[model samples]
Target: MADDIHTTREPDGTTHTTTVVDRDPKRGGGAGITLLVVAALAIAAFLGFQFLGNEKAETGAVTEAAQKVGDAAQDVGDAAQEAVK
Candidate 1:
């Protein structure tokens, strides 16, 4: 904080004084911003990991469906060969 005083003399030989008060500038604001950024990155990483896990589960399901279809196809081919015989 800062204070300033001004004194002035008028034409009527009267003196007037005034005081001004100023606020101090803030310091070390960067630490709060850094903390916010770190928090945001942490949340993003957590969400990304969760999404990756879900993707792996979906991929496994798709692979299992494909395998079942392939097995069915093989069984149909074996039945056709038996019929021809």
Candidate 2:
């Protein structure tokens, strides 16, 4: 069953057949390779999500920081004007 069986017919009423058989099935390598590929893809997906989530959080923090900076600048300008009076 492990070996491939093939049969062919020739033009002049001739037949050809080929069969190869293995006493034992070759094992191992295939399943390991498949598992490694699946693991690699899973890790890639997880890291991609983590990076995107962190990027979104960092952008929000930057926006908040910018608003705080604007408020502080306004307070400084108000103090300087009061000193001139």
Candidate 3:
């Protein structure tokens, strides 16, 4: 009489008696795509805050701000011309 058993040899010169299981390839790719989309949305929100926050400085304040900017530029130009002399 013989015993009821089975065995198998793998490709790497190894013997085993087990079953192999396979997994889907899309699971990992889906996770990577989800992370990328979340990161993009976060960056867009940060930039939107920076740009929109400046628009609410004050009502009817554009002329005063522009004049101040022009005066500062003129001062800088005078200093540069003096340094060159």
Residue 59, model 3: lDDT of 35
* Residue-by-residue lDDT tens digits, candidate 3, 13-85: 8997754444444556888899999999999999999777776555337878988999999999999999999
Candidate 3 whole-model C-alpha lDDT, 0 to 1: 0.80
Model 3: residues >4 Å from true position, as ranges?
1-26, 58-60, 63-85
Better of 1 and 2 by lDDT: 1
Residue 4: error of model 3 in Å? 23
**By lDDT, is 2 or 3 better?**
2
What does the lDDT come to for candidate 1? Answer: 0.97
Q: What is the lDDT of candidate 2?
A: 0.94
Clashing pairs in 1: none
The better-scoring model by TM-score among 2 and 3 is 2
Give the worst 10-residue stretch by lDDT in candidate 2.
19-28
- lDDT (CA) per prediction: 0.97, 0.94, 0.80
